[model samples]
Target: MELNNKKVKELLPQKEPFRFVDYVDDVDKNNKTIQCNYTFKSDNPIFLGHFPQEPIVPGVLLIEAMAQSAILLMLCIGNEISLDGEKYLLSKVEEVRFNKPLFPNQKANIISKIERSIPHFYFFSSKVYNGFEDKILEGKFIVFKK
Candidate 1:
């Protein structure tokens, strides 16, 4: 099903300042993949401490964005499983590489695909691309539903 930003917000647990996903571009259940977008606001509080003169989106937040995207994908496809009270947690992050720094006001596309899955764990390969379509970050991560 196609989900708008409002619907995406409803599905996501993260709130303002922390929720990185701004919109859902696509969700392909057959391929187990999801595409989402987020724009780092220049007024974000983190900029003050991260760097005053040159603010950049932290790599950890980029990873968090990918994890959020992955969770959205799971919620979209796993209709049989009830995720009402349970939360999805990052179990592990592997081979993460930041190719470019994301500055405030820059919009990024986050894409995540399920690489594999076990009982309660889902492994994903994720990437974040800048507006010009240059890959800014790439990584593999595991999410555990608990």
Candidate 2:
């Protein structure tokens, strides 16, 4: 199904600097796969304090990105994953592995596939890749409907 990035942003509640996933570039319902890309811009608040000199996107945000990706996939399939105007609430996180670091201006390509989702209980496996095609992070995320 076709989705708008701007509308998707509205579905997400994280807002501005805190929300890392920028757009849902594409999605496949039959395959249960999604591809999205985001960039860490210099005009953000977190960078000012994250290092001031060697600024980079935090690892927590990377994991959050994976969770957000799973939420978006849910929305794409059902169009009602957002609860009472809220989009995501991470319930469980497992098998988290940080393979590399993410730096400013780098494009984060997040790909997620549903392990299972029925009702509010959802599980997904996700991976993050830099613009250069190197593996940056990977994890499994779980979310429940509120």
How large is the C-alpha RMSD of every model relative to the true structure? 1.4, 2.1
Stretches > 4 Å off in candidate 1: 80-82
Give the top-scoring candidate (lDDT). Answer: 1
TM-score of 2: 0.87
User: For candidate 1, lDDT tens digit of each residue in 95-121?
Assistant: 999999998988989999999999999
lDDT for every model? 0.91, 0.82
Expressed as tens digits, the lDDT of each residue in 1-146 for candidate 2 is 54566876876767775677878888898889888878888777888999899898899888888877777787777756554654468999999898888998999999999988788688889999999999999889788866
Query: Model 2 segments beyond 4 Å from truth?
Result: 79-87
